[model samples]
Target: MSRTATAVPPQGTPLRRHGRTKIRYRTRGLAWAFMAPLLIVNLLVIGGPGLASFFYSFTDWDGLGSANFVGIANYVELFTSPAVLSAIQHNLIWTGFFLVVPMSMALLGAFLLSRVRRGQILFRVLFFIPYVLATIVSSIIWRQILSPTAGIGQALQGIGIDWFADTNFLGDPALALGSVAFINNWQWWGFLLVLFLAAMQGVDPALYEAARLDGANAFREFWHITLPGIRPTLMFLMLMTVIWSFLVFDYVFILTQGGPAGSTDVIGTVLYRTAFSENRAGYASSMAMLLTVISAAIVLGYQLLRKKLKWEV
Candidate 1:
């Protein structure tokens, strides 16, 4: 042994590499086992339906018989139809209001509510209650409340002033759409305010204390610390609001049925009418697909905005 050249092991090397390999193999097995159910559900429920809808969108299926594939003919018809086009415009306008009005108001409300000590929980409950109600139910209630000669109308008349006497809330071409959009805001902002307040609490208390010591008041602290801390939540909400705005259907359906001379029409209701009422399933599907593209573009733009924000934390 002494006379023979001794074999040397490599420096800082293990005698066996199998330990790490075994651990990694076990970890992967566990991960896959846990993920198996979720993967199955995703494939069946989400992926399957999505693919079917994509296939359906290319055909003129009346939810019966063999579907007739029409390719880009439906798309061509979508851009050419005035009613369909007007609904797209309404959807854009609705998206604008959803982004600007309710979200801004929610942020302000959350900020103010965070400063309160007593009855804060009650305030949250009261505000968020409306969000719990179904959109269709809320729309129906508002329809009654804003009735030209029935609900709020009679009350206003007793008060010696005409409220709905001049114009119908759900029946007027000019005011119906705006009124519906406004209701959407009213029913939505409270939930958003709660969400903002919840996200705000996750921010470090020490950051606020430091700001205060530096002579930074509430406004300054919010601008520098709070905004940055809650940036992700705000971004997510903004994107969601845009989608919901364009997809609004229950409220519009219940309130105006996409009427009041079609002033309250939007992409969702337009799609419904095109598919069922007009028996233009292919064209409706095309419009729907286009709407989906627009929504995706909006989401992409918001993602770019988030990157530009450069949130470090």
Candidate 2:
């Protein structure tokens, strides 16, 4: 005798409530197809160039000439060169200042703004306005403002302070790097503040409520709740700052052009001077490769730290 198979529904359940499982699979496949173009673009634009750069770093290809193969000589020379070493140090200083200046100020601005009631939107717009302006435009504007004949310098001179004529904002080696750093922080803070504000808005309301009801003051609430809520965003911003610090070229190029006496030369400016200005493409590529490695190490270390943090949480 042949046995008959029976289908049974356990408990109170709806078996034929919606469409068949096949529909879900087809929907996922369609979604993947829609995302295909984006993936291709990312690979082509970002990944392709990165791979090409890595490959070129090993060869000597001067703009229009044939590539001559050199082993690790480029890297060897990079380590031996004092200018290169100083540039790397300057890059680190830039990164450090960026974290302390822009990121801290932005976070503080976000924290304060979140507590404000009236005209929040207006403040957000005002703070973010500077970021919308291009680096070159801002640099030019600052140049005029710092000029001795017409702007801050003139006003100072009118009071017998004479900051520009006496102190040399752009000409002094010791102060030029700080000047660029200030410009960078001033231009970037608005964007970062906006980002922090947006991220803060997404934090869970219940967490704040609970913290308040538990005898937590505003500072306490922020320490325990707000910081935890925006930890991920903070990590991301930190990483992005590090990457951008190393890749800084536009502002440095336009504003100081690697400084009055190479005092403000960071990795990017150094690389540009080598590759284009001095016609040492291979050497520049080697410096670039080292920078890439450093950036990767930082990002990787942060990711590992994040993973550990998640586990602890």
Candidate 3:
């Protein structure tokens, strides 16, 4: 019997590479398919406007007509202008208030709720109710409550309590900014409380039991166990709070319009007024760029700190 040999290619031939090529191509196509819509939308909405703002920040564009390049003049004016300076100062103060007030209230509220065995859901709902309300509705409700002529003040005056009877919270320069902060806090702290409570609920029960067995009080347990356990959530919320404080606009604009003599003016309001009211769109773009830079710097700093300290979150 005669045997005929069939040709066999050596190992690592191109014939075996076809499968990997097909897989790679398929994976790339699937990825693009999933990402296409989001990428397109982001390009249209964010990237376009952001690039335009960056370009216009170096020019004098009045929202119409030709844009003339002005170099860094707008930034110089932004830093030197007293209104902008004051607005920046107000932003700092707002950030401080949010960092301290809402964070403290939320942590305390969440801790208390976490310890509750009865009516926890009811208390949570009540606390979160204000956060669920529309911003406009909340602002109006607070405005009425703070109204001197026909609201709480008058009601209190009728009952012979005059402490806030004559107080014009939103109209007085000294009180306008603080009043807005208070109103915003009223709506904000509850949301934070719910978030913190959720974080606390995720904490290991064994940790708490261990702490109790060690004769640790509630405060010590919270300081040592709860805080570290929920560090990721707490840190994230703190970062967001800082960023939001800088971008705060709606409440101040609705309640005070950056007045009582611009006492409550923040960078957000100042940017709005500069762009639309004063017809300095270029300058407003500069302000927007400044805000973007600040936010970016904050995020970058956080990332660096996390890397340096080897934070898991």
Candidate 4:
């Protein structure tokens, strides 16, 4: 019988493996050392206030002085209060408007812009200009544009156009919220277009060519290839839209301050009024908690849906 030969171990193999492991540990330690300062800052700035807010939510802390525990009274009032309820309703309406209007406009605009080979950058810059403008500036500009007297209505009336004559876009309680949403959308949709356009650019050109060869039209290619390719960006933006719609403060604060008989009041405006205006810090903290909970629930729901649907992105 032939003797089987065994393979010999390479010299210094264990030492080499040990050296690699040591190097990996050193790299990790260096990374942590670099990250430590920022981590500490975040803990102090964000985490500290977050914990304080949680503590204050359960107490009657009026921004200063001794705290007295009031349990869930703030929360009970938050749900039952008419103002809070109206703000919630407005937030829902705002969410619905943003989810549909801007998203659709961005998708269509991006798809169209993606097909253009000339002046694309110029067009993008033009579209994105409003997004970069300060919210206060944009709000002020829109306020002038929507002014009933000596505004767009007056200018149009000069041209003998009767439409929008004596129409108060922001002043009228019936039109206030929708008008604000429209103005916000003006600054928002372009930002979405740029992002969606960037996402669309990453999709394989080969697929588009193949679809064209298969006699597919613009709508079909967009429906199938473009949408699937940009789904992750779309989903992420949609998630942010929902969150930001609830947290919206700047435009509403600047434009109407939730006025015209509380027609434009949202959760953020109400929270601001409660804490600073009314000196109800504890109640405001509870509203803050409500916002935090709602945000968390939305994120959790998205995660669950993603898992359940087996989404790849």
Tens digit of per-residue lDDT, candidate 1, span 132-154: 99887887788788877777877
Tell me the tens digit of each residue's lDDT in model 2 across 187-249: 899899999988899999899898888889988877888888887788788889999998888
Across residues 224-243, which tens digit of lDDT does each residue of candidate 4 receive?
99999999999999999999
- Flag regions of model 1 displaced more than 4 Å: 1-22, 305-309
TM-score each candidate: 0.87, 0.86, 0.91, 0.93
lDDT of 3 at 122: 96
Question: What's the lDDT for residue 59 in model 1?
Answer: 84
Clash pairs, candidate 3, are none
Task: Tell me which of candidates 1 and 4 scores higher on TM-score.
Answer: 4
- Which candidate comes out best when scored by TM-score? 4
Candidate 4 segments exceeding 4 Å error:
1-27
lDDT of each: 0.83, 0.84, 0.94, 0.94
Ten contiguous residues with the weakest lDDT in model 2: 1-10
lDDT of residue 308 for candidate 2:
80
Tens-digit lDDT track of model 3 for 1-313: 1233225555556876787788999999999999999999999999999999999999999999899999999999999999999999999999999999999999999999999999999999999999989989999999999998988989999999988988999989999999999999999999999999999999999999999999999999999999999999999998999999999999999999999899999999999999999999999999999999999999999999989988887
User: Considering TM-score, where higher is better, how would the candidates rank from best to worst?
Assistant: 4, 3, 1, 2
Cand. 2 TM to true fold: 0.86
Which segments of model 3 are wrong by more than 4 Å? 1-29
